[model samples]
Target: FSEVSWIPNKHYSGIYGLMKLTLTKALPSDLSKVIVLDTDITFATDIAELWGIFRKFTDKQVIGLVENQSDWYLGNLWKNHKPWPALGRGFNTGVILLYLERLRRIGWEQMWRLTAERELMSMLSTSLADQDIFNAFIKQNPVLVHQLPCFWNVQLSDHTRSEQCYTEVSDLKVIHWNSPKKLRVKNKHVEFFRNLYLTFLEYDGNLLRRELFGCPSQASPDSVQLQTALEELDEDDQCYDFRRERLTVHRVHLYFLQYEYTPTEDDTDITLVAQLSMDRLQMLEAICKHWEGPISLALYMSDAEAQQFLRYAQASEVLKNRKNVGYHIVYKEGQFYPVNLVRNVALKNANTPYVFLTDVDFLPMYGLYDYLRKSVVQLDMAHAKKALVVPAFETLRYRLSFPKSKAELLSMLDMGSLYTFRYHVWPKGHAPTNYAKWRTATTPYKVEWEPDFEPYVVVRRDCPEYDQRFVGFGWNKVSHIMELDAQEYDLMVLPNAFMIHMPHAPSFDISKFRSSSSYRNCLNTLKDEFHQDLSRKYGSAALKYLTAQRNM
Candidate 1:
């Protein structure tokens, strides 16, 4: 396929341009026929009508295509336009009805190859890949194509003469934006078409009806306890009201669309669950590069940010190629960061048995992916209720080469360049990891749960969901770890595994927590309610270790 030369243009010069030709071999043997539509085409009418058109095909017809709407093939669109060979008006490959079984029945592969080779000798280079060869082939053997009506694919290019097919927008079945300028393309009915496109973009899909088929998975008794506590709170309790409002609102998952990475059976055991806002998107490359396994990433953003993130991710050198990362966008709501809410989304969307919950800013120790896999098996975490903690450290410097090994990390720790996360500001944050013992220990060590202890860990997918009641800064992760303890899951530290925090400016919520007394006071109230709810559900044993819970 590479032997044939293509016109030097970014839009239509890749080998993927010819992928449509190889679909007969690419798809399964049992798949008989399929409709292939370009990403630029938007259906104005029901697609069922187009599928029914297949019944109109003759036994000799193996492909269905609409005639190209412009005079490019006739070399009349521009002063010196040189398009490849075609029969009269060439057929467009944008919207195709492929009869795979019939194509394989005939020697379609060998025939197209010969046609392409023969045409290339004269044309020297084809502007469009398979579209050129396809038209050239049909010019010789016209029986293979069943010409579709032009209305089925209303070509909307700058030079498109498709006005002959439709006098009104209602007559068009599909609108194909064949030009790079798309909405900016010069058309007689530009406003109508542009408005139509924008209307679809801003359409409210909630108008569609949906049905729940079965009972939802029941929440834990502790969840009900928390709800009861919130319900019984005074009307003036702002924190409880905030929690209730967030809990009642449904979270939007896969905001635009979802592309779940398919991992090998052996590699699907563990998924890294992390949450980030738009500002942290650039960190995805380093995270993906170090962690080769599957990742469940939750992005917190507004509607505009979601669109911006989609564009950035598409153009990113590292993010564009990663099939192992699953991006779930949680639309930003209200003032709070919704930190735990974002965490819950990532956790719930994860498909693997175990998930390593961490922040997107942290880079895992080089071998942590493989190390955790071995630890999960050796520790029998799949069957046992165990959470393997990956000790976290942070550097004050904004930029530094991350330590690749535990020995290097220990060396940096000794040098005072790296310290346990929040060591000076808040020692209790990760103090439970007992880093003093971790320095010499070579095996997993049991960690007794303490108040406000929130270390990143790899736990089972079925582990308790993050407390939605804890919305913002203070107790977001603290409440989650407290629940895990209440549920009686063992927190064990992996001796070798570590995560280094790439420091950044404080989050909006954290800044709010520090400056606003009301914010801290609200967090304290929410923390009290959360602990009380846990105690009521788990019978006071859960909160026994704390005579007093510290306020952040």
Candidate 2:
């Protein structure tokens, strides 16, 4: 104990937040090069599994808890801070994976001051002080920062590790959970604050009930007066108000856009019908280069990233309005393995009448919006509950894990589009030049009437909202598809209306997606309902697509 001489710090309003700043200034130059955090981060997953990753991620430099400040917190990306992984933003201050050399050169002291500025930001010190400060440094100086796998700072959030849900745990390198804050706030003992509340209850619980019972429970006027004094206590209590806590739950309005990106003006809010995300941004930009409406981005993100991005997205503008685009953050927090929540989150957050969803990565070489517009004119598109329509295309990269035969590859590059089904869904919003009518217009859509029919495919943010009771990982979505058969919605597949899925690979390959807990949970959750529903909706529909195509 004498060799390490650590002091109990209590100099500022938020001493915990200032730990990073103090460490930056105090570590001896000759001390051990690496400074690992000994946080009592509650264990949620296998620490041993994460320990194995530290060795593999050795090439990576500097890691810590990822923070949500850069996205939505005012104090997080405060006027003085910068963006993440670039110019620096708020970072978790609890534990850091530091190359002390980098810290010294960047004037890490200055970075910490900007984040935890006890002397400068006494009022703002109560929030995101540690995490945001650490990240701010990394964003400001990217060359020094690297993301670690989940093992390091595992308990940063309150959710249990078993409850955690992320797209890939392999991507998580380190975990960080700063000291618990519920018991303490801004260097004040809040546990005692609650104790005071209890004390008030002890003094006046019976009397408080009497006030409503008409002055009968209180033994005397002093008792009634005591109740009044308690009521007024909140005004003077230093415990502070819970409702005023800057952030409680990260609120993100969800949406689904198919191919919704455009390289339009920064103010452009071109809205496309499908759910979209970064994977399809480039393709969307190409498909709807001229869209003048709002563009929806289908966002499927890591739970932590969801918090970070959602916060950032709220303040961001895509054509001016604050809520230009909604985020369908697909997963919940704390579970090392949960996938159903991913689909569930997307299912519930959709705000628009329609949602566009695709696994497209990068921009398309041709405009898909043009083909959709033509199809919409031909098919007579309906709204949310009426029909589900999509365009079909044959490209070298379209199908996941589908290998193109040499002859097919040589002749299939023709860019023209066509439709295998006659319904209208996503019409050309980006690059449309024409409109086409369905051949069987005025005909009644009857697939929904079939007892065996089911939803053709799962669309992110599609209606009737998922029945959450069916969740595990992937089970609920599959059930909804089965339920869709009984609901009477129409479905179709078109050729001319298609856009490239991008980074196309076989959908069945488990290895490509990363073997994380979320992925496993979803796969294991593929129960009877999921399979049957998918079989009715997509199995037959898919068979129809292949059978019909093979004959041609």
Candidate 3:
């Protein structure tokens, strides 16, 4: 009887038979040579012919194996060994003729020790675990291996066909159904192999039919109930299920804030400021349509980009309906985006007591304005010094129309897709860090101010404005946040409010800008200027604050 205990290989669970190969050391001393074959194969020729191949091996050779026909090993297995020519003849361990005496004499146990090492396994990229380690060892000692003919292992996989095999069907010595077990449903080659295997098993037509389609008696009551439940799931029930599973409720500090007073009608004074580019016209239009109330929009853009935007805005129906939108053109001759300067210009133009600083691509969700108004009234009544900070969300594009309610928006979005400013919040004494934990639900609840995130910030007009010296991408809005934090101002994040950021490419090309010496010089100059100004105002304390704020 050809019997062996099917113990799972520690590294390769799928190829469980590999565990038996490691125990070759326990075999009888007289048994010097043994033919190792995978279970998913059938012999076409006599077993004596395979044993005769041991005569062909050289003195240095300990094993004889056929090369893998698939290109998977060529890319994944041989990635690090790109320049080596030996990689072309990558060996397969499925059908190997092992010389037990030579292996024992050469101390083959060291290879098994390396396989047992967890650190070594973690470093390797190959999915076929044991085979990958074997190939790596063989490559290092190339003279210890002999390549057999492909006919000895006629692989039946997606890439391997009968026509591609080295030998004719009548002359073939072995049929290795390597992938037929998994690929029999979709692949014709695997299907053909499956039929041949069934025929060899002496399965009749009725038995074959029963094997292909499961027998009726095997069906369970649980499966029938599950089918009935699936049949009853309507579109509304599906939408409810999707929302329950996929929607992430971002809980912030404001959700627990006590609201004792109602906002007066006169307290709704907020000017929205955004630095715009030509490509963000759709975003501007969306903001104008969704944001309720007669709030002012102060938009800043480059001279050329502003002219292009004016033409677009005149034609857009969304922009035409809005009566309170204002555009300011800041003249700059070069392609460099003067983001901080543009924002400062917008800040200067704002007439209201409170300003909502945000990008053109962001818009407040429904009922946020009412919530903000109430919060502002409560804050004013309590005499609390704070800036309103709202978390930002990216929209999922499944729905055609803008979301009218939070419930509808939650249904459309995947909870896993929720992302916000990561480096904004910091621990009690630590410097600002972009820790991954800060962005998730595990974020610690503290009443302290969050620094360096300003995508959507509602601040008092009297607060420290944006530093005008900073240019392009890096540390543009961050300087303002740092200054506020250093001054002991509270940056309160509103839990109930979230602004949806419309999908668009970043305004500045970071890769192109980072390479430019002028961009680097501009950033360094701004940093020096900030250091000088803060040093003059706060003395040695400024350096300590700046160091922590800059993550130094």
lDDT of 1 by residue, 1-552 (tens): 443333332335367677787788778988999999888888888798998988999989989999998887898877877788787989999999999999999978788878877877877766776788889999998988999988888888778875687675567788888887888989887667777776665444332223344337697897688788767767876665465646544347663444556655764378999999988988899998889888888888766677678788888878878776788877665667777778888899887888999989999988788899999889988678998999999989988788878888899999999999989899988999999999998999998987679999989899999988777677788788888888888999999989988878888777878898877887777777787788788887765634556432
- Model 1, C-alpha of 125: deviation from truth (Å): 22
Regions of model 3 farther than 4 Å from truth? 1-265, 294-307, 381-383, 395-414, 421-455, 521-525, 549-551
lDDT of 2 by residue, 202-306 (tens): 342223333555523537876566556556545543322211121112233455222233343322111343334333333443334333333444354444454
Task: Give residue 231's lDDT in candidate 1 (0 to 100).
Answer: 75
In candidate 2, stretches whose alpha carbon ends up further than 4 angstroms from where it belongs are 1-293, 298-324, 328-351, 360-385, 394-462, 467-478, 504-509, 512-526, 529-552
TM-score of 2: 0.33
Q: Give all TM-scores, in the order shown.
A: 0.66, 0.33, 0.44
Higher lDDT: candidate 1 or 3? 1
- Listing every candidate in turn, what is its Cα RMSD in Å to the true structure after a full C-alpha superposition? 8.5, 22.7, 26.5
lDDT ranking, high to low = 1, 3, 2
lDDT for 275 in candidate 2 is 37
In order, what lDDT does every prediction score? Answer: 0.81, 0.39, 0.59
